[model samples]
Target chain A: MDWISLILIPAIKSLILVIVLLTGFAYATWFERKLIGRFQQRIGPNRAWTFGLGHPIADALKMIFKEEIVPSYVDKILFVMAPGLAIVPALLIFAVVPVGPNITLFGREIPLVVADVNIGLLWVLAVAGVGVYGIILGGWASNNKYSLLGALRTSAQMLSYELPMGVLLIAILLTTALGTADGAGTLSLVQIVNMELPWYIRIWILLAFPLYFITMLAETSRKPFDFPETENELVAGFQTEYGSIKFALFYMTEYLHILGASGVAVSVFFGGWRGPFVEQAPILGVFYFAAKLIAMVFLFIWVSASVPRPRYDQLLRFCWTFLFPVSLVYLAITAAIVILL
Target chain B: MAVSDGIKGAVEIAKSMAVTLRALLAGPLTVQYPEQPIAIYPRFRARHELRRYGNGLERCIGCMLCEAACPTGAIHVEAAENDPEHPVSPGERYAKVWEVNLMRCIFCGDCETACPVEAVVLGHEYELAGYSRDDLLWTKERLLEPTRPNVIIRTE
Candidate 1:
């Protein structure tokens, strides 16, 4: 590949991806507030602009002017770097997620994804797994007991949930490999999105979908599973000491992760950008991708508003005793079916 | 039994989600206070005002009953004989100095009930925020005025 195609294209795609995700992050806050407000029969935020469209801009201005207070007792270097560390992995997960198929522009083919690595699914998981360190470091460096406790819960939660998540994903990969005509499956997210498996093969994913959904909610630290930031118990958790733009960065990382997780789920399960007339008009694929992403995000917000947060012990126990064994049994059943077929 | 319990738990969660969905469809009951003014109850007591007769004469007879009746001692009244040439009120005596310290007034309407001629009545203006102590101290001139400031006055 030429320098322009290899380096410049990827750089440009990265720039676009960053801008879109940040903007999406801003609007996601407004969206959640409005939707959740409706769930409780309250008008959310309609003061900034019509239906609070400019609320994110107003929020950004407020955060920008706030006093950036670093506590006197904190480990200064780690405290400052933790928010940055938390945000980078959240943004990196989307680098391999293909938004749409390749489009020819000026007689040159341009893929919609930033970096289409062969080990895309693994890269998504690896980058997502790295995000917990940011919380752990933030909690530890604060030198407060509550922060330490929150950090500990976060690490425990991530460890317990990631096991089932990984096992289920491996099962998916095995199914794709075995179900294919060539019997050769690729780990690339773009390829997985493009694959059209038979109905019998798709049945395995049906069994895995609800389990994967639960894992996704846990991975994002969203409500019903948001043990780390349990305000009633931890008083803002790991971010208790953070203030101003540093705090804003931590907040931004959360929304970005939500968008990233939804993007990965869309590409992996819902066929990325596949829609009616998508092959005929490739640009329409981006719209389809956006529509699916918004729907997925709506599901997250709905779950948050409807479900109550479980106790920390109950959450961990549910994972270890119930989810773990159930997934293991499902994995065994899948393996047996794959071999028998 | 455990498997059935898990299924039941999932069903309950789904039912709760359905309730929230129903709430989402039902539009918000919020009354936009600034742009859309809300109706005040007829019996609601707020800022104190001194009433007047249709002939443009003050109803207060400067009896000092309200001052004595005020539980918080928020009301201050001074009596002076009304000038025969230009009577401020229909009565022989009128209030020379009248002040109501709103910071102390609990809006219990004790002063309103104590008035002999129905002079001191609490108005419907509820927005009583003031920047300073003096601003909150409603004087005779301020109380006598037909319109009240610092409140969004609406007919409804």
Candidate 2:
């Protein structure tokens, strides 16, 4: 009975999460292309099935059939290993993300999350930063000048943005503490989400929300902050020499991280999986969480289409000089406010 | 920067976003060629076609007016006396061989303007891809659209 509750159920939940995330990543790529196309007043990729639904499937098939290329200049072992290293953390981070409340299954209750750890927030942030190691290793292993340069830029950007992202997240934790009586805050995402939030408003316009989003975009290495892979300068940067399935793995890791980060954001900032009829019907909680995720991913695509990539030096300077100091001060203010009031 | 400058920047960004959003809702403006082609403009010059009169007699009198007017030397005409049994033209002289090298044709509609009897005019069949160079050198028959024997129009 204990094994059934602890081991078997958790294993099943993890498997389900991996399957859901993989499908989401594939569909997210198609959704981004479609939205970007509409923004540019063009019908992008309408050939593959209806509304190009089979495009991701076709892309996967093409990737599988493509000839694998490993440059003689690259370190063989690390070059082969880097993609898996980069992709694993992205898959592992979702273990703590809950989509719905615990429900009875065969006379036993099972939590929706794979692992609802006490330090879920910290666990996510910690694992999220580990994906950069794969990028660094991949760049270093490639033995190309452009790859090394991309690695340097990525590490520096991660250093610059990750701090502010963490700090602002702490500020959000402080906000959550104010709504509680004991002045103690749980880092568990599900616990944080179950708490009462304030009235309807533009939460994104708030300082912490905007700061978190901007930093997360940089963290995801997406557009407007896509300096490492900026085609004009780096010529695909770290991924220049990689081809076939290895390159596909890197691409998959990226979209997975974006979706996972959005999940975290939805859980923390917005009341995740908490909406009308969600309490009575736990299945509806999953729908609410998904709807919010889609909205966030839509904004991600919209912003990418609307803006151009920033110059590398300018991006670093903005992060260090402006965002870093502002987020630090905001964190300090929130901590002080939480203590005094 | 001043607070007003920040506000102005936000407004400008939003305004540009609004324009793109409107365009998104307006739907795509693509004309899918060969599948769903757009209607060609009325005066658009395309492939050349030899005309025939209502009595089914060819209008070309073999006067060599079009051959003389063509700038690229695309038009070629040869004159011969009309046969008594099976006359091709109403005029005494008829064209024995008429050809237009489509590769050299600039679609200028000059031959149509030069003709006194409206015998030659550029028509609306624009899809002109061919595998070999000889296929592009349109002969008299290839240039003309097939005319039906009975009504020469679609039935109701």
- Number of the top candidate by DockQ? 1
User: DockQ for model 1?
Assistant: 0.55
Kindly report which residue stretches of model 1 are placed more than 4 angstroms away from their true locations once superposed.
A61-73, A199-204, A336-341, B148-156
Shift of residue A307 alpha carbon in model 1, Å:
1.9
Best by TM-score: 2
Q: What is the TM-score of chain B in candidate 1?
A: 0.90
Question: Could you give candidate 1's fraction of true interface contacts?
Answer: 0.76
Model 2 Cα lDDT, one tens digit per residue, A177-264: 6555675877889888777645421252164776688898899899878866778888987888899999999999889988998999
Docking verdict class for candidate 1: medium
**How well does candidate 1 score on lDDT at residue B63?**
97
Clashing pairs in model 1, backbone N/Cα/C closer than 3 A: none
lDDT of 1 at B6: 63
TM-score of every prediction relative to native: 0.91, 0.93
> Per-residue CA lDDT of candidate 1, range B1-156, in tens?
255766787899899999999999997989988777676666788999998999999999999999999999999999999999999999999999999999999999989998989999998888889999999999999999996444443455
Give Cα distance to truth, residue A112, candidate 1, Å: 1.1
Question: After superposing candidate 2, which stretches have Cα over 4 Å from the reference?
Answer: A179-181, A198-206, B1-16, B147-156
